[model samples]
Target: MTDYKLTEYSHKAGCGCKIAPADLEKILSQRSGTSFKELLVGNNSNDDAAVWDLGTGMSVINTVDFFMPIVNDAYDFGRIASANAISDIYAMGGKPIFANALLGWPMETLPLELAGKVMDGARKICEDAGIPIAGGHSIDSKEPLFGLTVTGLVRTENLKRNNTPEIGDVLILTKQLGTGILGTAIKRKAAKEEHAKAAIDSMCKLNSVGAALSQITEVHALTDVTGFGLLGHLMELCSNQVSAEIVWSQVPSFPFLDEYLALNIMPDNTTRNWNSHELKVDGLIDLKAFQVLNDPQTSGGLLISVAPSKVNEVMALLNADGLNHAAIIGAILPKQSKTVLIK
Candidate 1:
């Protein structure tokens, strides 16, 4: 409630603060861990969460995500960050059981009361998701940061993987894009209030439908679109087994995106996202297109891969669940020289 803007205290906003995907790959490539048989999902794949089978037809899902302020309001930032972290569990088709807060604050500049408001906001979202912030760790830092380490559970048979979609599966995005550009606009004090609020609303909405989606027999693969942008995550979903055909116009985006794009408003990470996977893409003709494709998102949406025969059925489910922006943007196909081609 003070005049201090949280964005001014940090260099990057939201998921834009994430490391570039290509370099993250380089770092992960050198990682070594026990190859336990019960580990159904691990860092070996670019999955939303690590799933460990519990030997009772169920599995436990584990993940942690955090970021600096993407909005000026401390309360909204906490809600968005917590929603982003808990989304990994939903993306994996799990119902969150509990969460532990992770916080980093600058006591030298920001007040302790502001940090308390953040905790209050996060607790609200966790409660809305039917969970609690049971515990956490905190530290005094140079800048402010917050998120959650969420734990969830799912039937082993219903676990979703990003790389296991069928070649003919239809690709569905459950939320509109443009959070990065809008958030950047807010940071620069160029965004209209309505546009900034729209982005925050998108980020704060929980991807809880992911749990219900897993129950559908036709749903094949799932992953949330976050920092890496749509194309980066599509690359992971495509892997080497298949390629993707994205219909550019059909891709859902915030209606105000073009208004901001005219001013060249965009997150700094947009180019970083493009450079990471440009070699594997085609049919991208200009900077405008690249900006939309590679814009980093914080607590964005679910990218659901489903059997083509179930497209209508899935759309109905999404609409009923309040994801009206959800649309069939593309389809998975046999592997191509380029992993993703858009038109």
Candidate 2:
């Protein structure tokens, strides 16, 4: 064939390869029990990134995300992968200062030139975020993989956590859903260029708005959607006292996604996610709708919780940051029988 397809080398599709949430929970249940005073955020609550206080007004944020190829193009794969990784830094209300390349390639099966293209893609995105790819580790592997480990800085007061949303906070999603579905379609070579571009463009777009949202006092919590999908990540925002409601009409979704859903094209992670945490969701209206909600997002949007009075302010920022499609999907409320209900 005309050159090799990068997607053909990987068995998994981008963030869809993430471990099932329930299994992940069990794996994380036990910890080393070591503690550090400077550690402001740890793995205890599944927050976006680890924050280390420097004994000043600011904190250092660290997060690394890597995944298998989600697209057929090597450069796009790198761009999307890197964007997905750096997103974690922004999810924590911090500005990325630097990044490191994490690459895994099967040298025997793929050309080294493709891997170089992947690196170029990641470097460009890091530059877009005003950061440098200082260094990282690489290994030979069976599948093609690429991403970044990003470090950022945020004022201690502006640091956001996924589990800290308040009951009265309104929820905002800064991007549309359905990358997982489109990713599956692309992998199968069944996707049109237009549809594929939508997914890739969304994935390549940075959630840099997260850094700006940090300065607002009304914004209560923040996290970027990835393998877990919107529902899974939203569940992380819930506590015994906090729950959420999602209005489907207000939730943004990618174009042509319904067509693919009609074709029954979706990542395996969709069902894995729903089965892992379906008990926590109520108001089941549509199965397909739920699929989109449960779809694993590679470089997805930022899920924001803000005080009701400041929704306008947040909307203004999102619009200014070229995220005009971002919408107020629902609200955070006191815990009900289920943590999240879709209407």
Q: 147-251 in candidate 1: lDDT tens per residue?
A: 999999999999988888898999999999889998899889999999888889899999999999999878999999999999999999998579999999899
The TM-scores, one per candidate, come to 0.98, 0.98
Residue 191 displacement in candidate 2 (angstroms): 0.5
Prediction 2 global C-alpha lDDT:
0.91
> Candidate 2 at residue 29, lDDT?
86
Candidate 2: misplaced stretches above 4 Å? none
Positional deviation of 21 in candidate 1, in angstroms?
Answer: 0.6
Task: Kindly list the per-residue Cα lDDT of model 2 for residues 1-343, writing each as its tens digit.
Answer: 2577888888889999999999899899887788899999987668889999998899999998899999999889989999999999999999999998999999898989999999989988988999999999999999998888889999999999888898888999999999999999998999999989988988999999999999998798999999999999988988537889999888999868878888889999999999988998998678777889999999999999999999999999999989867999999988898999888
Task: Name the TM-score of candidate 2.
Answer: 0.98
